[model samples]
Target: MISNEMAQRINTQINREMYSAYFYLGLSAQAETMNLKGVAAWFLAKHGEELAHALKMYRYLIDQDARVQLSEVAAPASVDGGVLPMFERTLEHERGVTATINEMVDFALSAKDHATNIFLQWFVTEQIEEEATVKDIIGRVRLFGDQGQSLLMIDNELAALAKQIGQGAATAA
Candidate 1:
């Protein structure tokens, strides 16, 4: 069983994960507005992944026999800043997630909650990969996002990426 404090923190994280989904959804809309179909699809995939992330935590809480209460998710900030800024925002958001996970790890260790700590280790590794992936995307955006033809090429690449993701999912099933 999980402590009330731990339960509350997990609930908060779930809500934040919901917000992350919305953030990516909003970015998808922004990408669509910019006529970047590939980018929009990429963000939509990210949105779905965030939903899965929240669900993972929700299931963990339920498995722990803890109450799962959801709070309101605040609106994501405006995405009017464009695609490059969206990636920048994504990196920043990921950095914050990494910190929160670190805190949870510390808390788990302090409380001797080995199960929670084990569960959270997945997030620790996930965050590192997340941050690195976003950084790579940001670097690519910086390199190609400024040039029209180049940006279009990048968009095409992203479209292929989305297709590959779909294929991978299909094969896994």
Candidate 2:
């Protein structure tokens, strides 16, 4: 069985994952309001991914014979500054998550919880990909600088990405 302290830490991370979903959902809403359908679709995919992350942790805790104590999630921040700012904020948020996960890995290693450490390696790799993806989007958005046709092109690309993500989930199901 996992120690109570470790379990509590994981539960806290789960709450953070929920907050991520909430934040991304707010981003999606803003994208939709701006008529950036593709951006909205992308954030919707992100929101789903965040929820899945939380559920993955939830299952892991249950398998470890730990009670899953959920904390309340805070409200999402406003995303009123348009796409670039939204993505910049997302990249910043992801960096924070990466740091937290690293701490968890360190704690697991010190506590000799090899199972948890091994499991968290997946998240470590995941964080790398997450940061890279967000950074790439930020770069692309900055290049466009709210230009009409260029921004539309990026939106189209994101729409395709959203579609691909949808199809992948459908196939997995």
Candidate 3:
């Protein structure tokens, strides 16, 4: 059984993950409004991934015989600018998530929760990839800067990337 303190921390992480899903969904909406279909699809895929992340934590908590209490998710801000700004926000968000995961890892280590630590290893590695992916997208978008054809190519690239990441996650599971 997980300790109450650990369980509470995990629950908070779960809530944050859910909020991430909402945030990405909002970004998807903004992309759609901007007529960036590929970017919209990418954010929609990210929204699904974030939901899966939250569910993973929720299920893990239940499996460990802990209570999973969900809190209300805050509203996500709409991105009014271009793709670069959207991706910049995404990178910032991922960095924040990495920090949160690191905190959880620290807690698990301090408490000698070996199982939680093991489970969190995946997230640590995932954050590395997440940060890299956003940075790559930002770089690509910058390279394309206001070029419709280049943006299309980037969109296609992102679509493939989304599929690849989704497949990798599923295969790992």
The sequence of per-residue lDDT tens digits that candidate 3 reaches over residues 60-145 is 89899999999999998886678889999999999999999999999999999999999889889988988998998999889777
Show the lowest summed lDDT stretch of 10 residues, model 3: 164-173
What C-alpha lDDT do the candidate models reach, one value each?
A: 0.85, 0.90, 0.87
User: Which residue runs of candidate 3 sit more than 4 Å off their true CA positions?
Assistant: 169-173
TM-score of each: 0.92, 0.95, 0.94
Q: What is the lDDT of residue 89 in candidate 1?
A: 90
| RMSD in Å for all candidates | 1.8, 1.3, 1.4
In candidate 2, which residue ranges exceed 4 Å CA deviation?
A: 168-173
Candidate number with the higher lDDT (1 or 3): 3
Whole-model lDDT, model 2:
0.90
Candidate 1 Cα RMSD after full superposition onto the native fold (Å): 1.8
